[model samples]
Target: MRTLVSRLAVALLGLTLVAALAEPVPAQKRGGTLTIVRPTDPVSLEPNLETTAPGAWVYFNMLEGLLTLDEKMQIKPVLATSYEVMSPTKVRFKLRPGVKFHDGTPFNAAAVKFTYDRALHGTPPARWASLAGSLAGAEAVDDLTVDILTREPYGPILRTLAMYCMGIVSPAAVQRLGADFSRAPVGTGPFKFVEWKTNTHVIIERHADYWGDKALVDRVIFKVVPEEGARMIALQTGDADMVLFPSPAQLPALRRDPKYTVHETTGIRVVFVGMHAGLPPLDDVRVRQALLHAVDRQAILDNIMEGSAGPARGVLAPGVFGYKDMQLDRVYPFDRARARALLGKAGFTPGPDGIGGGQGAVPRVGHGVPAAPRQPAQPPSVHAGLGDVERGCRLLALRALPFEAGAAGRVEHVAV
Candidate 1:
């Protein structure tokens, strides 16, 4: 991960630094409410229902899955003490003893089986079902042992179990609360969910009887401030101790301030332009290649992104499993001449206004790019760059597709 300075408050600063440096550090002082400001509210507290970062972030504090990934991306046991791959389609897990959920329900093979079964066959299907589609079922062999069965030989089962969506919830609590379980979550983590007040805040208090290491802070308040400027102001005015997704433009100023810390790491997120290949014009590989050639990705990275992100080589980013440098042998350079020639060969001829049309003019390609609340202006700049590509190419027209806030699922369809 690329290095950036500290962004977390004093309570979390130690943990963040330790993870970054992989070195022992000073002991954290306990007993204070650490307020974290975010651009958007979590869609749901139920891990099975929501898959967005906002929801997952909250889940990390309140939920514990069977397995977890370390900073090195290696699978580590959490609720399950150890696991054995018995066969190509079956795996067995030994549950940790004496662990209890926040609601006092015991953590055992039953809990694991319940969690998995609920996710697989719940009335409202789990959003995570897509990730665990290969999973057939989970069975409790005994109080301390559970068996996970896949439809076939699923190699990434361990990694998939480490995902937040696989977090074990108290079966008793789920049965009691039913649909209300999403609002009032109960888990076996370091913290317990206290309250969630719509788009205002979601509060969690440190679990006194936590099975693992106790949290340093007495409470954590995830405050929702839709505006980036407002989140920054909250951090500045002590309303918030930490802020997520601060604008890249504001980083220089934040880095200069001693009162606040600005943390940066090479994230595994890849933001790219996606075209509907099944549609007209875009169906041609040459047209798509032309579009890529017209846009200068380096310029966007250096100028608009303020060097916050590195150039993406492919769909997956660095540090992610199975990421390969696809561009190692071939690179797409920014060349308008090549783009125009490719379009010309594809039967698009420049019109009087420099727009291309042969059989028919290429329709405007609509895209909906997710923008952080702090960097709303940055997306416009990016959109402008994409718009400039259409004008410069005189072959394709690109426009922003309107999308509602927090509607990330809709954006996935437009991925290139």
Candidate 2:
């Protein structure tokens, strides 16, 4: 969750790595307006028909992407100032000659082949086709050059063209505001798009012909405030200069409040707890390894993320790019007697009111924190190892909402 590019790189680089190791690093001053405070609102400023992270924290401050990353996550080149890997299904790039697109058009190579041929052929399809589903199109090779192609040999094609749905828009402002260019968005980025208001707020500004090193904030806004106690009371009443998911029980009183600065990091977003494995008691692989050894992933990273997250060993969260350590060969530790001996070897034992009597209910679907400290620690630690029989495997719902309405109600309750 933390990472609106590390909170706008510490609010547009006032650069404070603990005040550059304690002193002598001050002079950065430039313009002003910052505001932030988001918890929702911003489903599309059209970066390839965005897929929420609040529309990537406002089209990543108005979009640009011809590869990006760095902060040591490697892969650079911005509106493609260089690229090559031109064979195993091609690549090429090269653009960046006096870039433009804040709607005065001309960012060329046919606007990166009309923004990847309108996200590989648009009209209700672009969520950048699930991260450029191995692209396979895009040409141009002249104006400033371009190539792209791919339907194979795609080793994460330059981190999927540095994400934010492979940005690069303004094919003449999407052919002169077609679908109203997704509510008036246009880009080359370092801020531009200036107005949204929908669930109240989203601004942007700067970009005075920006082509690099220019945004020291002359407007940013964002501000939706969908309550984490009203975005910490709009950052303690000065009306927020930055706030996003702040309230892991008031983060130790906002880190002992010295006018607040709480910027912790490491979050590539991964919070698991998925199951439906072809139903019938999760299609028994010893009852899905006894519900991953009955909860307690370090007691949900110490009582529901107050230790600020770190127990997800898989689904790629530890600094992303092909993350591994899938707990190398077996290790699901919290053994409630090895989850009741793998639910009595998937046959469901325990009766005389100790529960698992008829063995069929394992529902537990959740969304964002607060379900009374995960219902007294994950369905009472897997219904105290499957012996609670009021419909055995319990804690069937948590629903805390607002990450795109709890991921569209967990994809319509996993498609019913």
Candidate 3:
């Protein structure tokens, strides 16, 4: 009987210990330090006054917006707990209680009013100031509720406010800091700003008393690394946990290693070369066209740019508005003879093999060879089949007579 009782007691204790271990323990929240490299530093942090997009992204994560967009690009709640659309142009928010700014200020209707009114009445060039113009009125329905009236039926009303640029600010912070908010800001976000070194880095630490679901990571270290080559090296060397823009030149080296996988998210950026239009050689549209025909875009794809870029079709990238793939088959091929023919037609007559004519009807320098032309005055159109190749031909067309014969019209690789 004694032996049985002892065995039973041991079993009971084991089960109790197992139960205790299995019981849901709160998530063990430990702070982590994440280092990221940026190509450039942010110009400013004042939400209403910030113009640069990259800096704004950092600022957005640090502040609360009434509404926010998820990965699917749909509108969702952020600072406001719940909201009701009273009319096409009006909204009422059920504010979340016990929310505090980084500076220990209460987030309320007055805070919203302070941010909006200050932007509207402060300066003509408030970062994104005109949003204040749309507000008809703002009033607190109660201590934890607020109503907002707008001037018009703004489509994507929630989405517009949800943009990263429109982070909410603390009224108390504004009152306390005044104009210096540009140098320092207070926000209700997962991380609070600790300090910044110009063109070097910015550090932020997680908020322990975050109102909603707490953040998984603790601290973020932001560093500015300009070169893609440097960014790749930094990642490999443990200097950076993340790199924003891996330069087009360094894609091959990154793919060779299997221990780390590259994470890419398609973004809304058009990385086209901005043709300077004010130069001389570029004034001749044919030279621009010839150079357009001159480059091996396929070569750029297979070699220089490699996996970093897709075949750029137009000003807008693959997913945005005004994008088309009609020009997929439209490209100037690599035939030296055709390139020479286009130059000849433009009155750029060449001797023997081919080169620009000296001292021709076109303006000439001391050697009778015309200097490089100036950039065209007009912004080159991004219409189908128009590109840097076309722009390059325009730059060289005026130098020789062989290029001028029928150069007024598009011919060969070069076209105006």
- Model number with the top TM-score: 1
Better of 1 and 3 by lDDT: 1
Name model 1 segments beyond 4 Å from true.
1-27, 257-263, 328-330, 374-383, 389-413
User: At residue 68, what lDDT does model 2 achieve?
Assistant: 80
Candidate 2 off by > 4 Å: 1-34, 39-55, 64-106, 110-135, 141-166, 169-187, 190-205, 210-217, 221-227, 230-232, 241-279, 282-354, 359-391, 394-416
* RMSD of each candidate relative to the true structure: 6.0, 17.9, 16.6
> Among these predicted structures, which one has the highest lDDT?
1
lDDT of each: 0.69, 0.63, 0.54
lDDT of 2 at 402: 30
- lDDT by residue (148-229, candidate 1, tens digit) is 9999999888888888678899999999998899888899999999999998899999999999899999999988987767
Candidate 2 on 241-340: residue-level lDDT in tens?
A: 5676555666666556554445556656554545556656666777667666665556445554445455556666557888886771157766667866
Give me candidate 2's TM-score against the actual structure.
0.32
At residue 100, give the lDDT of candidate 1: 96
Ranked by TM-score, the better of candidates 1 and 3 is: 1
**lDDT tens string, model 3, 1-416?**
00000000000000000000011235654657778775677777777766554477477657887888775566788878898999888899887788999999888877776666666556654656554446654677886777776789765556556767767788888788888776677889887888878888888788888888777778887788766578767766777666654544444444344443333444444433333333444455654454345444444444433344445555554444345654522654544455445655665555443334632433111111111111011112221122322212223333322222233532222222
Candidates, ranked, TM-score: 1, 3, 2
